[model samples]
Target: MNQASRDVIRPIRADEWPKAKELRLLALKDPVAPIAFLQTYEQAAAEPDSFWREQARESARGTRVRQFVAEGLEEIWSGTVAVLIEDAGSDDAFGGAVLQRQAHIVGVFVRPEYRGSGVIDELFEAAVGWAWSVEEVARVRLYVHEDNARAESFYRRYGFMRSGETVPMKGDPSKEEREMVLDNPQLVSDIS
Candidate 1:
């Protein structure tokens, strides 16, 4: 990849989760953000460094979950994506529902300045690569707020199609979350 391109994508180091957490809080502060993220900045900011460390460790730990960051030469974080593998028969954060083995994508964000610069494509390349690299995963899926058209479009561009599944946001019965899935895990391709 070219310098400009290569400089944008990589895994968040175990030591960098503090910054990772910070940037994530920044992303949550965006205006259209509420519909994009499940957690609020206030909640994330209240977390201690140990919480951040545990999160980072789980992300980098072999397939339990992973976080990838898009950084520029100055090490500015421009984007990020995290994927969590849901084990079969284990209840997810949502409730009693269980999955055999599917990767759940979440915590996706791209800086406004870099939103259309192919930065996300690389970040996703790393994420989907890691997702597919796992053996038991049949697919990778994510939920988007029904009103988040921009994120819906980006997700569609990544080959994620609506699965006709919708769940009420945990605490908000008024809004629904739509599930989108990359049905063909083997088709993950290069960004450029």
Candidate 2:
């Protein structure tokens, strides 16, 4: 396959559970895993195959949830991002009330070699586009570890801004994750 075709970014298929599990495992092994993700490699690796399959199926297709992967040459996934819908009046994973319908981006990771090659840019573009297309989605949001400057910088570059809210990281009271958000660009354009 041609190089251009090798780097396509697209939604994963429901049956691609193995690929999803593989990419997630790889993400957990990254140097920033502890601060970058809430789950440990050991915990995820110990999950049964059925769990992975169910996760893949649920996120593969639906307006409420979506997972996108950047497939590199030879069809290996080089990066992935998942979006979970948070409805208004409901409690978020952090125990905070969800004030608006939003897409909560999670599990973002790109292979080390693909980090500076625009792979992440493409992934965010796709994820944010999907979020905005969904009905009543006011924004897209993600939380980054306070000490993860590199990730925070990229989120800012992608048009997200610190929301001035921080939640204590799970299992670690000393570390906090800061919320960042990107208001729907179409709304910005309309108001301009």
Candidate 3:
């Protein structure tokens, strides 16, 4: 679907490693980057070409993890999200989650201009749809910074509720991150 004449959704190809890396750098440059991303541009850019190549290959076919990107008419990626399959005992970037059959949503980003538009919804539809489509996944979840009210509100609109669970930050152990779980729509759909 085109929004204001912009074709906003597309999957990043395995051959598009360089583009992925570039977009990541742009995301890190944003003012909210410090909280939005776990890694800095300096760390990512410092990686050799091999790292980009491997990232592309993994996201291309890894059932455990997948990346989706939204592009504008200019073919510039405006947003992205990484979905990772986490079984009951899987450990993610945030550490271990004991929720036996769930997926962790991470690496979410949207360009300033694309905020408020359906661009985010489309990206989410793509990610959450993939999560539910997985036969082994029972639910999906994410962690947001307590200080990020905007993100918390967005998650609420998306059917994610605070799980009342908190995990300390991996980098800064003194800080805490809160968990939010996506309501399992299957329960409602199955009833009807």
Candidate 4:
């Protein structure tokens, strides 16, 4: 059987904070973490247990955010992705002003061993599926660092198109991140 078939993709639970924290720390240690994530290993490692618990709790049940994980047969997490709903006229997680009702994909990570095993695709399927379920979401978007060619390529293959928007990488004005978007197919069909 394929790896995707052996694993289950589902939203995280509030009680799984420890696993979530572990996976997040591992992701931060990845070589691409510098460009893949906004936070550093030192910063995340310094946070207390309460912080991780709160993060897991919010992601588990918060109306504005949801985190999904790919769990293997042994209950091991293979990958994770999160979507945060952004309301029009409200501030986004990046401290930017939001111009539309959208879902911002973030915290994407897959265990190195699981790369190319279809786990990432399953994770995105779950994340984007949940994003589309939100009535207020008109589109789903994510930012890929300009230097992260692998991620950018994957996003393109997964049907995200560059929206011609670029934002300066936080704390590194020399680098930039490109915005990619996938409009809601249901909404698109309705318009057509």
In TM-score terms, which candidate is top?
Answer: 4
Question: lDDT per prediction?
Answer: 0.82, 0.90, 0.81, 0.93
Q: Candidate 3, residues 1-192: lDDT per residue as tens digits?
A: 446237456567789999888878888898887766678878987999999888878888857788899887788787898888877776666556565778889889888887877778888888998888887676799998777788889999988999898877657667667899985688557767
Between candidates 1 and 3, the one scoring higher on TM-score is 1
Worst 10 residues of 1 by lDDT: 183-192
Q: Alpha carbon lDDT of residue 121, candidate 1?
A: 81
Better model by TM-score, 2 or 4? 4
Ordered from best to worst lDDT, the candidate numbers read 4, 2, 1, 3
RMSD of each: 4.0, 2.0, 2.2, 0.9
lDDT digits (tens) for residues 1-192 of candidate 1: 543385557777788887888888888899977888878889888989899998888777755888988888898888888988889899876674766688898989888887778888888888888888888677888999888999999999988999898888756779989999885435434212
Per lDDT, the best of the predicted structures is: 4
Higher-TM-score candidate of 3 and 4? 4
Show pairs that collide, candidate 1. 88-100
Q: Would you give me the overall lDDT of model 4?
A: 0.93
Residue-level lDDT tens digits of model 2 in 1-192: 333245889998889999999999999999999999999999999999999988988887666789999987688788999999999999998999999999999999998877777888888888998999998888999999999999999999988999999999898989999999999978778779
Score every model by TM-score.
0.90, 0.94, 0.89, 0.97
lDDT-superior candidate, 1 or 4: 4
Q: Candidate 1 — what's its lDDT?
A: 0.82
Task: Indicate the worst ten consecutive residues by lDDT in candidate 3.
Answer: 1-10
